[model samples]
Structures are given as C-alpha cells and as structure tokens.
Target: MGKRVLITGSNRGIGKKLVEQFAQNGFNIVACARKKDDSFDDYLKDIVRMYNIDVTTSYFDMEDEQCIKRELKSVINKVKTVDVLINNAGYGQNALFPMISSNELKKEMQINYISPIIISQIVSRVMIRNGGGSIINIASVSGIRNEQGRLAYGSSKAALIFATKTMSLELAPNNVRVNSVSPGFIDTDMWNNRSEQIYKKVLSETPLGRQGNTKDVADLVYYLASDAASYITGQNIVVDGGRMI
Candidate 1:
C-alpha cells in the first residue's frame, strides 16, 4: 500500500522492527525518535534504499510537550498526511510504589501518556481532514495487571489504554481507529535489563511459555491499520500469550 505510517521510538527494538515490517509491506514511513542515533539513522537509510520506500526520520524530545506538537507538525508538512500513527516511544520504570518519586512518576506520565495524547491530537486532526487513519499505542501488560513494582510505568500505560478507548469512541465517526497493544515479557533490550527472578516468574506465568517478539506486536498493528480490521476500534488487544489471564 502507498499509505504512510508515523512511528515514534523508531530507534528501539519494537519500533525498529515495526518500521521494517511496514516498509516491506509498501507503507511509506515516518520514523520519530527522542534523539539521533547514527547507527539507527544509517539503518533507516538502508531501509529506504533497499525497500525503495519513502522514510522520514525526525528527532525531538518527548519530554517537551511543545516539541512533540511542533515535530509532528513538521512531519505533516513534509508527508502531507499520515495514514497511521504509532506512539511507541516510552521509558520503562521498575520502582515500587513507595520507592517511586513524584518527579519520576510525573516524568513517566508525561512521556508515556501525555505525550502520545498530544501527538494523537495533532495527527487525528490531520486524519480527519485527510479522510481517516489508524492510531496504535504500544502499551504494556503491567498497566492492567496488579503486579509488584511498575508503579510509575504501569500507571502511565494505564492512562494510555484509557485514552485509546475514549479516542476510539470520539474518532470512530471520522473513521479514525484507535487501539493499544500490550506486550508481556517481550525479549528486547528492555527485557534484557530485567532481573533474572522477574524473568523466570513472567515466563512461568505466560501461557505460551516464551517471551513475545516484536513481530507478534507488529502484525497486530498492521492489521488494525488495514481494511480487514475496519470494524475494530476501542480495543486493547493484548499480545502476551495469555499472560494477562
């Protein structure tokens, strides 16, 4: 398809995999990151050359609310309009409830919850003007689970999931779909940093008996962005191998 996708956190594991997946499927890409990475940028460049796809890489700090809007405006200026938007840029938190500081909690909410909403507000307007689009939020399993730790990060993602529902309802009339994907124990750099005991517990709980991969999440997003999933909206589709159950 010739449609374009705007994916934040493009330098990270899942984000990078999502870029290539959409590119291979012939979707023009707009890759957004908090900062510039030479190696990652070079990788995106190679993707453009090999896939013969249009790719735009943008750099801006998600912590800055104004910058979030400004950068997305810049993207719209260049791409004209984005058909799909993925808010995948988020920092994980491992602090227990009492251990989490107010500053840390606010930071997590700003980057993970507030920032995605701000970006969605901008892009949803564009989508409405351009006849509609899809918005996929990459949330986490901790958001819905009553797990130890994850006080800051889990609350932030919980806010995102709620927004996904509200947005889907409001934007449905405009044909803009909004949904979230919550992945559990996904094997990425983020997971690499987890304590061995934590990893073992999650693996044991996962019905699939294995950690998830980026493709598992990407495939669901791609479908939601496609016509096949035209009737789906306001759904938080978990991709954690029944871990939530």
Candidate 2:
C-alpha cells in the first residue's frame, strides 16, 4: 500500500490538480470538499481504478469547527495514518479596503487562516503519533504583497503563512515538516471570476508575462511532500513568476 494523503478543497482547480498529482504518483487519498461533487467523484473513481489505490471522500464546511474535527477523526480512524495533508481550500476577495466590512474580514480569517490551523493541529498530532508526515498550506502571494482589493484575503493568508513557520518549528522534532506555497495569479476557477482588467494588469506586472497554471503549484507541492524536500520546512516558496521581485 502507498502512503495516504488528505487534501481539502479537492473538487476543482488547484485542489483537484493536487489530488491527481499525488494519485498519479501512487498515493492513497483522502479528498475533502465543501460538499459532494459528481464530476470530481467520477474523476476520483477513474484515479482509483487506474492506480489501484484507496480513495476516501470527506465533506465539511471549513467554518464548521466541530464537523471538521469529526470528519477528519473518522478518516484517521480508518486509515490510521495520513502521510501528507494539504490545506488548499480558500477564497480570495476583491473588495476595496474601505468597503471591506468587519464581518467579511472575520469570515476570511475563519476559513483561510483559523480553519487551516485547526486542521493542521489535528493532522499534525496524528502525524506525530504515526511517525510523522508533511504538511503544505496553500497560501497566496497577496499575503506578502500589499495589493489593492485584497485586504481581508491578504491578511488571512499572511496569518496562515506565519502560522506555517511557527508550526514547522514546533513540529520539526516530531519528524513532521510544514511549509507554505504562495501562488501568484493562477489560471484557476478564481481567476475566471476576476475582471479582464485585473488579468491584464497582473500579466503586465508579472515578469513571466503569463498566468501560472495549477500544475505549477501542484508540482512544487508534490516535491515538498517527498523525501527530496525533507530538509526543508517553514519556508514560503512563491510561484509568482517574479512578480514580487
């Protein structure tokens, strides 16, 4: 049997890519989403048949703390060990700072930052008990950059980035590793919803002059989960096409 990996937001985009990447590489999967998705279910079915690996589906709202714990606990009870956990479910907001409400900020923090930390805590303990594993938090470059119309989303990712560092430090002794992958403009479902003006603006600013795809992020994540990156931890590796530079 291959090592098992648990991933959140596996219904589409980068989450789906991450699931497929690991599946292709022969990993048992615990794929989670906010709700059930038929297309994604079919995709997983194909992966299971192709790889001959175990694949489990978990559903929970990131805002529901108890449900998150309960669902993960059940998966853990069955699999006993998850070699990797990816916190890949998050949303970006485009509201201006002045227009952003406290409720909106709180909501972003809850789902993007706090929930990932909670999930990490639960899974890391399991990793510790199971002889350790790896964790990757899918953050955004907006966390490190002070861009307009991203106050809530940016701040939430910033908190998550910092949490990844702290968690890595504490968990290192237990043979677990934690890192953050900060992606720039990726051509995903989130990108499709944004305005064309924003797209052009980002493209002009990016040194590569093209938007990154989900595979770009997934490839990096796959390496971090492997033994090749065992010496790495607590780093916020950017996939931004030199936008920050």
Candidate 3:
C-alpha cells in the first residue's frame, strides 16, 4: 500500500487533477468536496476505475465551521497517519475593492484561509501521533503580489501563505514538513469563465506567453509530496512561469 493523502476540493479543477495524479502513483486518496448529486457520481466512478486506488469522498463546506469540525472529527482516523494533506479549496474574488462588501471579504477568509488552518490543526495532530507527515498548501501567485480587483481573494491567499510558513516552524519539531504551491493563471473552470479582457491582460503580463494547465500545478504538487522535498519546508514555490518577473 502507498501513503494515504487527503485533498480538499478535489471534485474539479486543479484539485481534481491532483487527486488523479496522486492516485495513479499508488497513493490512497481521501478526496473531499461539497455534497454532490447523482450527476457527479459518474465522475468519481470513472476516477476509481482509472486509478485503481481508494478514493474516499466526504462532504465539506468551508463556509460552515460546524461542518468542518464535524467532518474532520468523523474522519480523523482515516486521515490520521495520512501522508499528506492538500488544502486546495478556494475561490476568486473579482469584485473591486469599493464594491466588495465586508461580509464577502469575511467569507473569503473563512473559506480560503480560516478553514484550511482549522483542518491542518486536526490533521497535524494525527501526523504527530503517527510520527510525521507532509502538508502542501495550494496557494496562488496573487498571494505574493497585489492585484487590482482581487482585494478579498488575494488577501485570503496571503493569509494562507503566512499560516503555512508559521505552521511549518511549529510542526517541524514533530517531523512534519509544510510547504506551499503558488500557481499562476491555470486552465481551470474559473479561467475559462474569465472575461476576455482580463484574460488578455493576464496573458500579456505573463512571461511564459501562455497560461498554465491543471496538470502543471498537479505535477509540481506530486514532486513536493515525494521524499525529494523532505528538506524543504516553510517555502512558497511559485509555479508562475516567471510571471512575477
């Protein structure tokens, strides 16, 4: 059997691709997402067939604190001693600063930053008991820099980056390594829905001359989860194709 890993928001986008990649590499996957209907059952079944790995699905809504606590407590044993935990459930904030409400900002923080922190606390205890584990936080390039209309989204990821570094220091003594993967504009559903003007602007500034695909992020995540990254922690690796330059 391979190492067990729990990844949130694995129903679609980069998160979904991560699940597939890890499972193919023989890792047991605990893939969580919001409650799904029958329509999505086929998706999970397809992945199960393709990977030949155990993929456990759980209902998690980050906006609800009670849901997070309850879900984590119930599955604590399954995730306890797990090899890795990927925090990947976040959204984009497209509203301008003046138009964005305080409530919206708070919700963004709740989903993008606060929930991941809470989940990590629960999982890290399990890792400690099991001797050690790895944690890979899925952050964004926006976290490291500023954006015009991404006040809430960017700030939430920024908070996550800080939490990742601090937790790495706190968990290092216990042998648990924590790191982050900050991706550039990836080809996901969100990117597909981005306005043409916004997309063009992003592409123009990106040094790679093209946007990234979900596999690009997933591949990097797989590498970080391996033993090759054992000595690396408290670092935010930017997978932006030199976009920041």
Candidate 4:
C-alpha cells in the first residue's frame, strides 16, 4: 500500500542505504542494479522481511542504451506507477585530464551523465501518467567546485546538476518535481577505493575533519522523496559536511 519508488544502482553503497531508509518509511522499492547476487538478494530479503514493505529488484546497465530501454520497459510493465525515481547509478573517475584516457572519460560521462538522462526520460513518462512524482538525483560536491584530479567525474556531475534544474521546469507542468543531492567526501566504497594519499588529502581539507557516511546521504535523499518536500523542486542540495565552504 506504500508509494512505489524506482531507485537505480541500489545494490550497494549509498544507493543501498537509501533503499533501507525508504523502506523504513513504508515505501515500495524497485531496487535496480547492473547485476544480482547473494549479497544483494540477502539484503533485499532482509529488508522486505524486517520492514514488510513491497520490494522488487531489476537489472540495469547504464552504459548500454539497449539495457536501459529493456530494464525501463520491464519496470514499467511490472509497476503500474513509480511515485519516486532516484537517478543514483553513476561512477567516479579521478585523474589529471591529460593522464586520463579518452575512453575512460567517455565511460565516466556515460555512467554519470548520459545514463541518468536515459533513465529519467524513460521513467518520466511513467510519472507523467501517474499525474506526479519526485526525482532525486545523486550528484556530488565536485559539481560545484573544480578539483585537482576529478576532471571527468566533476564535469559529468556538473551536467547532472544542470539536468536536475532543467528537468524540474519541464516536468513541473505535469506535477513532477526534480531535485538533486550533492554529497561531498562521503564514506562510501567510492572513497575507500581511492588511494590513501588522495583520501588523506581530502580529509585534511574537510572542515568537519571526517568523511561523510552513506546513511547521511540516504537520509537526505529519503526526505526529499517524501510528501514533506511536496513544494520543493529544481534544487541542488549539498550534503558535504561543510566541505564546500
């Protein structure tokens, strides 16, 4: 009986945490991922058993346009309406521009920027039919500030931020709201995978003196997707633990 939400890349990290938070709030979740395994299966089983919320999993590959189309089709066919859509499937790349390969740059953009666009377009149709919905895009602080080695990732997030703003305007007439959550120095696998030197440097600069946790981002995202944010749209909220300032 809860509102249905379709969250991309929900198998791990911030996306996974978001799934848990939303489920706690009594939301029916369509947790989409690029693949499936025991870990995610167990996670979903536990969430469903514990929260008693309706939960389904879908397979999605952002880089493959065909895969995006197929997954969207399957979701729409399965769920009559998607009350909330979270564009959170993206990748991060850090390296000097000259040192980064063109293919790598393209892959970053495809996952971080293009993939969201495709998913939004497909999902927005379902929202349009549902009369209204909320779109929460997971962006990054790099979207607002330039960093030493985040050339590709930063640029892609910047585009996503812009997309959230513009999509809000276009979807508002149909009663849909679009917004973004930009987190800085989140303590997710993305950060853990970075070199120790880079991580240390980032931590040294953060005013909070620590990295953020996935739950931090998940909480904010869940709030934005709720009825409490009914009047909010076209905004990029920075949840960076004051790292930007």
Q: In lDDT terms, which candidate is top?
A: 2
Cα lDDT of candidate 2 equals 0.93
lDDT tens digits by residue: candidate 3, 165-245 = 999999999999999999988898877798999899889989888999999999989888889888989999998778888
Candidate 4 structure, TM-score to reference: 0.96
Give Cα distance to truth, residue 164, candidate 2, Å. Answer: 0.6
> Taking the tens digit of each residue's C-alpha lDDT, what string does model 1 give over 1-245?
39999999988789999999999999999999988889998998899998999998888898998887788788789889899999999997788887889999999999999989999999999999999999999998878987788888999999999999999999999999999999877878888798899899888999989888999988988898889998899999888988888
Model 2 lDDT per residue over 1-245, tens place: 78999999998999999988999999999999999888888999999998888999999999899999999999889888999999999976789988999989988999999999999989999999989899999999989999889999999999999999999999999999999999988989787788899899889999988899999999999999999999999999999888999
RMSD of each: 1.1, 0.9, 1.4, 1.3
Q: Return whichever of 1 and 4 wins on TM-score.
A: 1
Each model's lDDT comes to 0.90, 0.93, 0.87, 0.90
- Which stretches of model 3 miss by more than 4 angstroms? 78-80
| Reference-based TM-score of each model | 0.97, 0.98, 0.95, 0.96
Report the Cα lDDT for candidate 1: 0.90
Model 2 clashing-pair count: 0
Candidate 3 lDDT score at position 172 = 98
| Candidate 2 similarity to native, TM-score | 0.98
lDDT of 1 at 157: 94
What would you estimate as the lDDT of candidate 3? 0.87
Candidate of highest TM-score: 2
Looking at model 1, the pairs that clash are: none
lDDT tens digits by residue: candidate 4, 61-88: 7889998898789878987889999999
